[model samples]
Target: MTIPQQSGTFVLVISTGGTIACTTDPATGARTPTLSGEDLVRACGTTEEVRVFDAVSLDSSAMTLADVDTLVELAGKALGDANIAGIVITHGTDSMAETALALDLVHDDPRPVVLTGAQLPADHPSADGPANLNRAISLAADPLARGQGVMVTFGGDTFAARALIKRDTAERRAFALTAPLTVPRPAPAARAALAGIDVPILRAWPGADASLVDHVVAAGPDGIVVEALGSGNVSTAMGEALGRALDAGIPVVVSTSVPFGEVSFDYGGAGGGASLGARGALPSGWLRAGQARIALATALATGTDPRLLLGV
Candidate 1:
């Protein structure tokens, strides 16, 4: 699949280690991120003058919040460079959605930032990295992809960073958007930052108790995200613990564990959504638990009230 490219357009490829850049270790038979950004560009067979920068060389599972901050800084610098037309980031799919959403919130640049990766290692016979890299570069180079905020282009589809989610564990087309990308906005002068803060996610399972919630609250995290049961229902004890966290001024966001549904405050029992809402628990709309956590962290880092962004 070939995408039209403009003459003299230069693309900056930032490589962070993921399966897309991994190779098999002969001794251990384990895959690792050993390929460079230049190698990826070479595999794609692109003729455009590409500048490669190796950001990190580790699987996405090993990625940290600090790594995310570094990637955002690199992308911001690349987008500011006059010689660069756009940027492509090769990332691991494990936390791709979280990283993408983080970048979208902070990177206001209109220039395209395309994130892509593969399920198979680079040295595998059926490695998908080359193809995904090609598609990402094509999207990054295309004028039509500009000003769409940061996007993930995988499996021949493009998703807005804010709405993108990793839906499948081992599927080639792992990402899907909860919503669509809208208008472009100016890149903010200052990007959001995190300090390795603790933000625990507690799921409301059958016969769930408040012990986990109490422990998390005692840890004094910046916020908490609860993957509540259908329609955001929690056990009585869990709801009370969440209420206590909110009362202590720690933001509590309730998200549905269900893949596709909005959390509502309709039920009004001891451990119901409405009860939690009355005690200051906020609804996460349709955001998944991970996305809600990212949003909450970003909001706290930027000194913005999380409730304002969450529409609670």
Candidate 2:
């Protein structure tokens, strides 16, 4: 399938590759991006009024800041057109939260931009791709969703970009909210309120390492999240690196590797989790790395200092 030649109530499907693009072989049963954007549109069974764009074909793991920049640019252009009802981004669950937060900060559009993905390949008998895709489109076209910032819709719940976390690796209902439900006021009035909300991305961590933390501190980042081990502990190397980062005018936060849990700094000593809190690093009680990143970003964007934020 090829992208439609004309636009009409376009949904603007930006394929930042994931299991949604995969298909199983007839004999070998191997899955891959055998399906294209056009294929997805056809599978959607929606009218020609909806158009899809082959924005990009790389796997979600391969998505980068450059890809995010391109996506933001594309969504911005689409939102500018009156005929485009909304935008839908297909991405990997691993980094979806980060990308959503990033977009929410920079995208000033009032139109709904929904992000959705699947844990299983589209060809599986119990594949969740179709349902997720349908709901994403529905939410994108919903006037109620406008100005809510980027949202992740899964398991019949709509999550605010800043509060979302990928909680399950293989479950269909993977996206979960780290914070409590925050209901915005009615539309028209709510848009103004949303416009005032500040979300920032001080640092985006693909993985955890002390060197990364050190670099951020050296550059004078106000705050940063260290994706710590187990229940929020880092190796001796990473802890020392964090100390260096803190010494360089950077405030550090310890976020748990497990998306759901209370991060305790009870084990205070060398090469332990509690040592971070003792060393002036803040412990994000139940906040996952993604949530911590967004909170910190919002704080920095609003001109909050790391030392003050960490109670240092």
Candidate 3:
């Protein structure tokens, strides 16, 4: 699986824990994502042509926005180095899509930042980790992927960071594009999304309230997407703030804070899911909250209407 190492291309493979690094105990058969970067790289068998950098290692699910910023800074610095060609990040599938979008926003460099991971661990014979890594490495090393923004390579597909959403948990084919996701999309659509969606969550207050919304709006948010709790329930105060944002012509999208379920406006009344809707906060409906944010950001970045993508 060795590629002819390019003369000057340096590929940085950041290993954030996932099935790609995981191994199962023969006795228990329980799954885990804890393999090392060097081990995973050796398993992938790369040639001497491309130099590999084993970057920081951690679990993607437990990752924070701060981690994203740090990674972006590292990537920016790496790209600044004349020897580096591109970068590859092996992240947990759980929040891989989120990290990809965040990285895409922060790193303005055209060098490819490809994210890859598996639903199964490296120990499994049929595990998809090796292949996914190989593909990511190749794509990361490709000049065409440069200036294309961050990407997620899995199941033999190369997805734009802005268009991608991790839609599955245990399946190998998890990341997919938004509606009418192009078969082979290019940089324009990707950049269009990156412009506005790049707004990172600097901090979040637990109880939803207008103060927070005011704070966010005053900070000059083109739009704000709330990662609300179950069924889109936020504090009544938060709901009021949301309504204010809507009244002020600010677009607010509500997505479930829960990671694994469809966001339903089932809280009935009083600024619950339905109330949020009545207040003009668009419900994510089917899109995962994080992915929904990315789509909204991309739309805002390109001056494309968020309602158009939301179809609300």
Candidate 4:
């Protein structure tokens, strides 16, 4: 899977430790992030002056806002001073989309900032890391990748970093890109605003009531995203709960659990998208629950109305 190096502009490969860098822990028989950035670069078998470095080496599910901020700082630095053609970020698939969107929100440069990772551990005989990394490195250095915003190169697909979803659990081609609510929107708030900001996704299900929303509302979160059934429909009880959340002055964004298509407020009822829209809950068009939550958090952080960004 190693791609032979070619003569080209340099690419900066920043490793943040995901399955792409993971190896088996002989002691516990658990896979952990053990390989370093240099290890990944070597595995790429490229000689394109890919200067490699690391920012963190933790399971992506355990990544926090502070970790994302660290990467944002690094990306900003690279954009400012580096003469490299593009940047490649090796990250875990679990939370790759969130991090990529964060970088995308703040990204204004033309040089590509590509994110990549593998589902298999680096130590596995059939590991996919080398191939994915090679492709990412190539994409980052490609002139055509410029001005594409932050991208993710995985399983042969290159996609924009907006509203990406991990569609498969164990498949190599796991991530699916969801459409952004808008092409360009407000700028991100200060990194400080990303701290202590909470936006949780509450999924709607059979017999599900407002208890979940009520409990979260009691905690006084910044915002909430409801993953409703069909094209955004919830139980009457849940709709009332969402009303209470709005009454508490919290913004509620409604997204669809359906894999494809956008949320439309066509249905009108106590718990329909139309009712929710009328009740102050905004529809998250083309955004799944995960990215919807990120969008809401970004909106709350920047003091921008979530409706302006997410309403369909």
Candidate 5:
């Protein structure tokens, strides 16, 4: 079923290649992102009078920080246009959550920016790209979606960009909201650029030493995110390395490895959240490790202390 083109409410759809645009190469039998934006739109059965633009055409796993920045700029430009009612982005699901969050942090236009993608390739018998695209377009054109910020619409649910996370690698309903939508008070000013700062995630493991953490710090990153165990506890050695990172003025944000819980500086031990907090590490509330990394990088780029931005 195709959505009829309406006279008003113009929508702009941007396509960044992902599984949703993949097809099997006849000779090599390999899947690749070769479909054009128009092709996907047509496949989705949409007859809406919307503009389409191709931002990039690579599988999402191959997406770089440069691509993300480009997409942010493109979306910002489209949202700024008076003729465009809203924007829909078809992206690779692998990094859709991160890209969505990045866009959310930089753009404050209050216009809907809906992102959606398919888990299976477009040529697959049960491919979901068409249906997801259809829903994203519907959401984008909805007046109610405004002021709700960027959103990810998938599997019949619309999630705030700040709270979206990809919980499964292969499920159609892969993304989920792990935390409550955080409405930044005194709305954030538009960011001039998204500085692609390298912020690595260090996962704490049982009986693990600080060697890995030491290596990461030695590499000179703008910040580090520790995927702490439990309510934010790491190995004593890992904790020590985090302290060193903080001492060096490299901000460290601690996020829980658990799927659904807030990080807190409650326990008291060498590598406990409390110890880390005392040593200058900040809690990430309920954000998962990956999301925390995005927040930390954005904070560092904008010259805002992540601890304050996150309200730790």
Candidate 6:
């Protein structure tokens, strides 16, 4: 699909690398990122004079928070460039939401940043990268997307970055966020050093013990997030260990493993969110474990109260 060009408007295409840019090795059948930013823009078949920049070439699973810093740093340059209307980033879907949220934290500009990618590699017979790339470029070039903060456009749908969730492994329409998630204010920024710190996640399960929690706490991690049971409840053993971690001044956040509900301080026992809340544990309002870990890390990196990061 060819996107109509605006009179003088242009969008910057930033390629990081993912399945959208991958080529399969015939010998080993291993897929690797091989396409550059210009390569992707060239395949769009549009007359629009889109600018391209190659950022990195790694799978999202191997992506680090420090890598997100580089994206923000590059985007910052566009803030002063009047020629660019918006920015579109081609990224791996695995950790796209995490990196999008991280980028949103420091995205002080009004121009929207749109993220998109495909489930199939570029070499596949039914590869969806070309279509997804064109759609992303169209959205980025549109004046309507301005001031909407970070967003993802995939499979013909557009969603605010905060609401994006990748649910299907290989489905063409895996991303499902029908509505925009608005924040009263922009996400607070963090210290440069803290973005690279390590934060681990623990899950609460049937007859779960404190060994994992104890070991993680003993290591003195930067912070921790618990994937609790219903309504954010945990086993007594795990809760006690988490409480100890809190006492040690490590920020602890409780999030439910359930995919559809928000976590709350609804119970009163030692394993309950209420009990944990009383002991300085914070509830991850609507964030699941994945995004919670990223937000918790950002909170620990800054002087702001971590509670503010949970509500998004």
Worst 10 residues of 4 by lDDT: 1-10
Model 3 C-alpha lDDT per residue in residues 1-312, reported as the tens digit of each score: 122234465677767677688888789997676677777788887663345544555667777655665666566667766666788888888888877866765557778889998887788879898889889988987887887778899988888775457767777788776545532332233333242244433222456456767787777677778777776778777777777877887777887656554566778555588887877777765455776675576667656656555434
Off by over 4 Å in 6: 1-8, 177-194
Model 5 lDDT per residue over 1-312, tens place? 122234566888899999899998779978899888889888988766676888889888787777887888888766656767789999998888888887877777878899999988888989999999999998888888888888898877778777567889888888887665553422453564555589998988987798998899899998999888999999888888788889998888998878875688898878999999998889987677877887787788788767644546
Each model's TM-score, in the order given?
Answer: 0.91, 0.71, 0.65, 0.91, 0.92, 0.91
lDDT of 6 by residue, 111-217 (tens): 88999998999888988888988988888888888888888888777777763568678898877532234434346475344455779889999778999999998
| Pairs in steric clash, model 4 | none
Strongest candidate by TM-score: 5
**Candidate 4 global CA lDDT score:** 0.82
After TM-score superposition, the amount by which residue 245's alpha carbon in candidate 1 deviates from its true location, in angstroms, is 0.9
* Cα misplacement distance, residue 246 of candidate 6 (Å): 0.9
Q: Scored by CA lDDT, what does every candidate get?
A: 0.80, 0.66, 0.69, 0.82, 0.81, 0.80
lDDT of 4 at 27: 91
Candidate 2 Cα errors over 4 Å, as ranges: 1-8, 25-29, 182-224, 229-241, 261-287, 291-312
Sort by lDDT, top down from the best = 4, 5, 1, 6, 3, 2
Span of 10 residues, lowest total lDDT, candidate 1 = 180-189
TM-score for predicted model 1 compared with the true structure: 0.91
**What's the alpha carbon RMSD for model 4?**
4.2
Clashing pairs in 2: 200-297, 200-298
- Residue 232 C-alpha lDDT in model 6: 89
Per-residue lDDT of candidate 1, residues 110-218 (tens digit): 7899899999898889888898899888888888877788889887777877645788888888888654443232244257666576677888987788899889888
Residue-level lDDT of model 2, residues 139-214, one tens digit each, is 8887788878788877566787754688778877888865455423111110111123322223323344566656
Give the lDDT of residue 310 in candidate 3. Answer: 47
